[model samples]
Target: MDQETAMRLLLKGATAFFLDVPSGMEFGIDMMSWATGDKFKGIKMIPQGIHFIYYSATDKYGNTAPRCGFFHNFKKSECLVRKWDPDKEELLNVPREEIAQYKTNILNLDQFLAPYPFEEQTKWNGLSSLLTENVITTLCPETTIIRSAMELFPASKTENVKRRRKWGPIRTDDDVGYDHLPNLVPKAESQFRFTEPPECHYPPGSSLSQITKHSLDSSYILEKMAEKHHNVIDLLAELQFCYICFLVGLNYESFERWKKLFQLYCMGKDAVAQNQGLYVKFLLAVRQQLDTVPEDFLVDIVENNNVIYNGLKELFRTLESGDFVLGDDLKDVTVQLRRFLQQKFGWEFNGLDEDDDDEAPVIINFDEN
Candidate 1:
């Protein structure tokens, strides 16, 4: 649903959950961050308690507004998902407390449901749970876990049959029922785990070498021009090198491995420190998604560099996506690169060809207080 509709339909007193976090393990509902708004602090989306999602924005008083949330942290297996109430549209902090229990036969099924959201919800019952629950009625603390294994096939694994994660309380066999009445949760081909792609070698392309030299030369000029300022050209130059290093690190583990040794992650490694940390997390998440990706989506890069890719796209798609650019200073570089690509039959002849223009400046606002 559109963010607007989602806000309208989602219930108030709601919570969210993330199955993975603390960078790579399940996080609490209270720790999730709302996806909307200007608050720079971020949060993970909680995987459970999402039944409260509304299709349109509704204020605490039930008025309509934009929606968002912010998750600060997760602790003790409980989700502390922070949220943004659209009515006020401010970031909120919520903490989930973990409760421990033992396995037992139960009389009231709601006891099993009690550990879940106490309010109304959409139960996306995966086939593994659905099939298992029928044979066994008592759900101890252990049963609630959503196994990643069941997600591979659609409700039915048949061809032309679409797959889904969850269904509402009601189900029409027709919803996932395919021809021939095959089991809705059809068994799968032999499934196997995957290791990350082997790192590829990236020899410095001639085009990349030239651009690198040009960047350093440009930095020198900018340095001379801004002699009165803090003179951050060296810092920019280092960052530029780090960007290449990131691509190098991504393409080859050896390069990154070598980097980690001399790279004392204490104070001087520059942003590479954060990049290295995020890179590991990115790889892990990519591995998780690939576990069940539809065979149809094979070509999409699972290791989504969306933050870098979209940040660049934002400046190109619209002037309003961000206010990161400085006029004239970086504008000339954009014009030059477009002309070069047209003149030379240039392409990403090699990895890290230095194709992107650093037009959108990262504005680091110094705190005045």
Candidate 2:
């Protein structure tokens, strides 16, 4: 089929009519973004799935505001209408009456709509395949909008204000003269509700031995987090959700949570043996996520003392240890990931050095009478 005919058929798939967005404003769906021209109205041929629609409003002086985005699950042949509020610099839902008119005039307006970039569909699918409506509703801010600069409010309104206020007069060597600065917290209604890691490494009333073990191996915390999910796949879904939020939405909070989740999964040696299927899926997800990371960011990882490398090494050691009889599927993907890392970043996972702090055994000395 000709390109025009193919686009026409795809346009019949799903359409978004973005009305009155200023020319030269940044607009994007999924992975590709472009500066809209005077004639641009919106996007067409969007595939049927949950996709992120994001844009930044450009001012008269050529200054651009922070990017804002939201997720929408489009259905086949569905039409969506959004009007850009120039004064507020935000996308607002069009009135139902006006939406009906746009639907009627879609054929006439088709010329102004840009076709979705199908070339990115495969990459987008790899990143977002595990994302579900449940994951969106659970983690997204109550306002259902994600902004690169998250909204914040004075810390006084937060639950931890009392504790934070108590530290106002206390000065630590690390304070660095910023202690006088007023504390701010993410707006309650605008914060991503990511699952927090455990506050305590061990359960209450645990013996000294159990506490020491839990602190060294995060399997107990992993088990605690697993109880909150329907299954292990749901846990993986949250990981994917955080990655997309950080990668596409530009939310650093999501990125931090993603690292924490990755660390939890990697550090839990017992959890790995208990859930082989989950580990297989986890390795696959990690590989795909690493593939998408920018080269500059990977360089930062190497510069920051090989944070990712160390995490993967710990995981590899756990899997390779003769104690566990791991599945072939798990072993195969693990090998593939190791090979990819070696070729891509020249990372080796043979073993940690005997003199390395991580490998050295801890010794507690006691004074004897």
Candidate 3:
């Protein structure tokens, strides 16, 4: 490291003191992780910004627990302290007094802490730049914990009893069926509070023609979803939030939500021209997001009819058409994104064949009035 860089880190970098964590457990900040050793306390020289801290406990037999993590925005030269609860196999907050004491004795404790891997910072920023403090606070569970495997609770007694009565008594292996299994649901407080997509794609009391248009385009649904946010940018922030949760926190549910949001953005042609600034930002966000996705995942996407390719094809077609007079900024970002996809994934936007059945427009015949 350069002397100036080291000095800057010493003055501004934050520290995380993880106390009494067992050896052989997996611990990480951002995109990197390690199987911790006996001397490992936590990470130091952490850049002051939003980051994810994750860990998993491992048993003596080498079986690792499900991953758990939280997002925290570190302040300049801050000291954060957490203690491991061996019995619970979870990280818990230390008392204010203990945290203060830890900060006071940080110099003596520094030797046990590892420096943050600065090399990964740029990659992390690419994935997380759009995420704001508000986004994390809004979307994360009330407990501020994200678990790879969701914690579930047994269904309510009334509902379970109703199902049991319908299924009747079972005697043997053959009798065991889906209805006989207990209904499990995620705990309310522990579930991510993602903004729910509009239940109905079209507006209430819309004409059949209007309904068909809305169904095909989803611009109305996108507009309704934006109404829930303070502004369009917050919607984009939620998009970023969902991606990070899926990518870094290893949450599959968040991945599903990300797909929903991505689809909404892609299908909203009218909304793009209406919210030009948002689409420009949206394209940039998409570009950054694709960089973080693994090549294997892209292969799976390509095999599954390639929703991303189809979506972008429609979007680029709309921009090229003479219907909308798009701003130069939007046009520039769109060009950059097209070039990026071409270089990164061999995805060509120009001269694309319109062979997809999904692209066919819906036609509704209204009764003559």
Candidate 4:
């Protein structure tokens, strides 16, 4: 290439960190900050503005893979090359596409493709790789299954297959007035659900105000589950997603009751964006709490996010067992939590033994931050 052409190319591209990262993110001078801690090394600018990054760490383990998170911009503008000099402590730029097929190396591609299981990865980063790496397309095995389940069946036989069907009028269990609810909505068939707790010995510990409120709320979730189950029988008309709806009902029934009292479990899905952000943050914090939590953190199912916390426990167990289980039941997810609590917070709470397991489903929630 001509000198001017080479110079332009080199300037737009430069290595900012030794570790792999997303392409298309303008490292500017903040390349080191973009990478995870400890992996960063240094960068250099080749002639024509091209820059190469160097790292002290290498594949000593014969790590046949390169780990990277590319900072890709969907905007199709060709990026300017860049440079970083330790002496000047600044980043410089060169013309676009300075390096030839930068993402082609097999190792780099593998790292880019490895973060997630085959599920959503395809629709996200994996799809992007389609342009550069053809070998990764082998995921079609699972893709075919998903395709058949989501689309193919529906297209060919709508009557026989149904997952998206809506059923049962939405009833308000929160403080809202049931009378004011849409006239067609289903009414609560019974004020309470379930008989006396199975003959299990009662758990020790009286209710803290928080736990009390949670217990009450959990009782409601259990009631709802039972109601959902019965309603299925009445709506007897049938729905394509009947099995899925029944699954939800079973989970509700499993939530028998709790020792603590709880308030109505109410969270509205307002169309407002600000409210949405708060909800998202609340859910994330809830998940984080579950990750490293005390056994007693479970104030009650109603007060906390049972769906996700239960999911995490099940995931932990699944991981421990080294068997990947695709599931939706929340309570069953407790298989791992039992062991986790026993190990991490062995305060020795009693009622969790056979009596409780036979009497009713256990309710757990992570402690507040």
Number of backbone collisions per candidate, in order? 42, 0, 0, 36
**Clash total of candidate 1:** 42
Winner on lDDT (1 vs 3): 3
TM-score of 3: 0.89
lDDT of 2 by residue, 211-303 (tens): 777766777777877677666677788898888888888777787778778877787878888889889988999998888888997798779
Give the clash total for candidate 2: 0
lDDT of 4 by residue, 242-357 (tens): 11111212122112222111111111111112123322332232232333233353545424655433333332332333223323332233334445555654423343222333
Every candidate's lDDT = 0.26, 0.81, 0.83, 0.27
- Model 3: runs farther than 4 Å from truth? 161-179, 352-369
Rank order by TM-score, top first?
Answer: 3, 2, 4, 1
Give TM per candidate. 0.20, 0.88, 0.89, 0.20
Per-residue lDDT tens digits for candidate 1, residues 1-369, read 476543333322222322111121111121112222222222222233221121123334645332221112222223233344444333344443321111121122212111232221122221011112211112111222212223234453433333322322434456655333443442343211111111211223537765444332222232332243233322222222222222211112222321221121111112222233322222232222223334343333223422322232322332222234423423443344334433432311122223447543232111111
* Candidate number that wins on TM-score, 3 or 4: 3
Candidate 4, position 103, lDDT:
25
In model 3, residue pairs whose N, Cα or C atoms come closer than 3 Å (at least 3 residues apart or on different chains), thus clashing, are none
User: Which wins on lDDT, candidate 1 or candidate 4?
Assistant: 4
Each candidate's root-mean-square deviation in Å?
Answer: 24.2, 5.6, 5.2, 21.8
Residues 282-309, candidate 3, lDDT per residue (tens digit)?
Answer: 8988898898887898789888867678
Model 1: CA > 4 A from native: 1-64, 79-347, 350-369
Model 2 misplaced stretches (Cα beyond 4 Å)? 1-8, 154-163, 166-183, 352-355, 358-369
